[model samples]
Target: MENDTICAISTPIGTGGISIVRMSGSNALAIAFKIFSSKNVSQESIKPRYFYLGNIHTADVNEKCMMVYFKAPYSYTGEDLVEFQCHGGVLVTQKVLQSLIESGARIAQGGEFTKRAFVNGKLSLDEAEGVIDVINAESESELKASYGLLKGNLHKEVEKLQNIITDILSEINVTFDFPENDDEEVTSADVLEKLTRAQKTLDHIIKTSTTGLKLKTGTKVVIVGKPNVGKSSVMNAMLGTDRAIVTSIQGTTRDVLEETYIYKGVKFNLIDTAGLHDSNDLVESIGINKAKEILKNADIVLFVVDGSQELDNFDKDIIKLLNDKKVIVVVNKCDLKQKINSSILPHAEHMECSALENKGITEIKDKIYNMVIDEKVLSQNVIITNIRHAEALSKSNEIILRVITDLQAGANLELVSLNLQSAWETLGLITGVSGTEEIIANIFSKFCVGK
Candidate 1:
């Protein structure tokens, strides 16, 4: 561990009942003794992991507070650590941190503490990233995926794959070392079989990323259709709130309205766009154009139509755009007599609903949730939410495939082993076992100061 002591406010710097100033390093205990004194424990008698009621005597003020200490090799940073629980006010926490800094503790950079923990072998690279995800998570599903990473399951799986490659490489090397050891003779078929199986396992992981990425970045679901199709009513019904301006008049919503809702633990960005139609008015034209633009980029498009009215040219034009798109034809206003024939819609099963009655709204939500989330992978808890890990896994899988091909072509075992070594190193990028300092620094730089 580094010898320089680092300190920061571990809690949010705002009004609360309590705030913590954390310090970690070899000199943390020495620095704490300079400003904090408790009669219950002396410098030599201070117990590790024991709380001590103390008074922080600074030049500006002598504030009474509580302190706790943790010895090296067992703390969060795997070094000596101390925490001072002070008043929750911003000034109080800042003064406490400044006092520690004046006493020889330097301010911690963003995520230095967790980075040190990684350096000290307390966590893998992916697990450290999980820590960040947990802190910034907005939904239960995001938190669940983050916890999976933090729990080290993904690291363990990668380690197993790496070990398989390592064993194969060792077997290949043994054949080169002892040519007469016929039992050690590794056949190309054997190597190909093992690598192929590993490739399949890795491929499944990458496949889940299609939906896994959505867990981190909420799915973009835009509800669009012609004017007076009850698009705003659908948005309100889905959100269970009067978010968008609901009016019977056509083109009332002359702009895109966006709101977020959690469905079955996954987060979704439900966007209600202006009615898509030919517009002579300038502002409505702008909104219509904007809706068309975003519709091109949406993950899911809810093509709503009024069941009480037949499809018009405006609806046909919008349908032209919905082709080759992931769409749900919402034949809204099912409470009235149904006149719209949903069979004419080319894509997706048309969902009939009355937005005013809130009928079928729950079913629409269920279908939306089911469209993007892969329940099997989420149930297995092996989602690849992090883009970095996904890319690394992909690179490794590609390298392994090339190795399999070279082996099948009767290439020399030495050449095959070299490609396998590359695959191993690539997988190591996710775990930090064989990563460069630049990647590590870049990852940690994104974390908050206290973590």
Candidate 2:
């Protein structure tokens, strides 16, 4: 938390086309200038928020790079920041960071830059987490959900609830002090009605967390069937790559093969498992057992079947195992005449595809994605993608409901105000601040009565 200038390799550690080294703090520009030299460029002549082509002198070599300066109060960390975009290489980037460190700047810890942003009021705690999500997002759906938080959607909602709670607490306090023969029961009823409305709002937000969590963590879709029914081909066709080995031999996929693909901005974990049939070999048996266990945890199961063949005992057994799970019967190899009856597979979505020919693969992805996500429903709502945010909302809802119940049961104004104040403070946890000052400010600002 020191104001000392901190530096680190901004880009990922590796040999690439280009790499960036970054520094932030009060002495960030000064420390950077110690090792960087540009023609006609000095501290007095430096322009803030502008890039300067310079040479960074290091213990090992001198690297020609582009350096940009971000002055305090407008930078990412709300302090003087500098970035050196140097030639991409492990040795070059490390040397640039080393020179800054030797010139009196310390290396930055993981997430310290963003944490500093939060500490300096550039971002709230939830928004800070959103920054991490955006950095780590592997799929488009997850990125969209992360942007919702980064854009202050949840923060604004929480502030609204805090304002409501502030108003209620202020009203109760004013009524208690005035005591002009007010109807106590009527006032309590009105407070109870307002609390219920906030509770419902919180309930709706908590409900969206389920989908939000799925977006954050991609759905696991396990594909299981008897071997040699083109399960590997189905995987390769969907991914447009030879991710799994395909052969005409039975039990080719003796182990679980997992890969990920995005369909309509949502990520799905495609798992190819060993054929679900009796195997004499111990290794094959273990693989079959593993596939069965994976199905239990899968968000969705792609129950594959040979479309040109009739139902075998193995297919029936696989169907029975998926009785309680979300399933999509993938009638694969449907280029020939269809022989597999869809009616027998009850309570499952049936989709036909010829994996060998890549026919209907897109439709199956559409079906799997549609089965898990409904973008239309979430289009207008702010999703609670973070577990901590969801938990805070849930805890606030619980406390508010309790206060409502106590109010209905004849709790006095003083007692109800205490509980309501607690609820307001709990809601403030999301934004990393308490409501004591906020309540005092609210009372004076919203009410015109003499204080």
Candidate 3:
């Protein structure tokens, strides 16, 4: 199966300038040569690193294309590769790909290109996961983190930690074999110190993942306040577009309008909901109910207050609802003479902004980033951005921690060795040195076809 040739459409399936039909395996170039017709270059005459202009004649149509070849080990999949840059029409590309598939090239699965990259030692599990992240990134911050991962930033950190763990395990094994030498040179306290340091490092990485995951996935920011308090206006400013309907009439926005945007390397999902006001209208009531539900799951509540109006009883109700949730008080309509008292809200950070005038929005973004991602955490940070890497690292840490606890509680040396070996195996799974067939399939399934 590893030696089987694979082919698929690399570009998106739609009208565009061009589309790519990619093939990989030992005979990628041969399969491509079978379908291409070029007067200037023959399949046998084409070199390993040349592009030949050609015509792809299918059963129905003739498609103009460019054929490029990459010989084994230097290619993306670490095998002989060929790419057909053909017309962008969906039908034409499919016909060309199908023609190649019929010529001894099997259709590549979703992410098969990258899967081969992993199997052939072109990338680690973390780096492979980053390829997916780069394709799926929705914001600037996410793309930066994904780029870092793809470049092996997270892999280096994980490998370094694994090396430290390996050293500790070696020491443990040496102590177990030579009791007198262990007593003369190193004590159990030395082992405890090493384990404690490793545990702290793991804890730090876990903490960094909290922020990294948020940046990748985005923070759920819900805008809540009384009706006519400019919640929709604020949403418009934050999104830099008017996605939500805004009018002078109260309850103009009777539904939850969500828009995601990037600010200073952080992604936020700004949710503008129906104004938090008592209503009998069924539709408005449904929207209000949804607003409350969204608030429950939100990472931050942007309580937008109408600065030109006095604080009403409903404003107090909103404050009561956010008893435990992270709240950011936004005094909207600050361009007008202020009427609401900021001192009333205790311990909540207040920012004056005019969503209408596009004033002070940057301040709001800055505060959100600071509150969610602490400066201290970023000081010693190498975050596992992918869900798979985080899960694997966490499991490895758990196994090692369990071993340490058992040893501290007077467990046998062999018991500690078993757990230590298990931890190493868990870490190996992250890099595909030890992984199940199902896990590989599951990871690849998330990729775009012909990735």
The clash number for model 2 is 0
Query: What 10-residue stretch in candidate 1 is worst by lDDT?
Result: 341-350
User: What C-alpha RMSD separates each model from the true structure?
Assistant: 1.8, 7.4, 2.7
Give model 1 RMSD, 1 decimal. 1.8
Tens digits of lDDT, candidate 1, 1-451: 3669999999997999999999999999999999999889877899998889989998985888999999989999999999999989999899999999889999999999999999999999999999999998989988998999999979998998999999999999999999999998998888889889989989988887888889998999999999889999999999999999988788899988999999989999999999988889999999999999989999999999999988889888988998878999999999999897647566676798999999999999989888898888777667899899999999999899888878878898889999999999999999999889999999999999988
lDDT of 2 by residue, 1-451 (tens): 4688888887878889889888999998888889999995987789998889989876696899998999888989898999889999998888888888889988886666776776689987777777778877888878888888888888899998888888888788778777784753238888888889988888888888877777877889999999888888998999999999999999988899999898878788999999989889889999999999999999998888999999899888888899899998889999989897656577988889999999999999998877778676367458887776787788888889888888888988788888878888788877777535443233223211110
Flag clash pairs in model 2: none
> Residue 317 CA error for candidate 1 (Å)?
1.3
TM-score, per-candidate, Cα-based: 0.95, 0.88, 0.91
- lDDT against the true structure, each candidate: 0.91, 0.83, 0.83
Off by over 4 Å in 2: 177-186, 409-415, 434-451
Write candidate 3's Cα lDDT for 1-451 as tens digits.
Answer: 8889999999999999999989999888777777788998986888877888888876876888898888889988898999989889999988988898788999988999999999899998778988999999887667877888788877776677678767767777777677678454444566567777877877778767888778777889999998989999988988888888889998888888888888876788899999888888999999999999999999998998999988889998888888888888999998999897646567778899999999999889889888887555444436666677788889988987887788788776666667777777788777776789898889889998899
Order by TM-score, highest first:
1, 3, 2
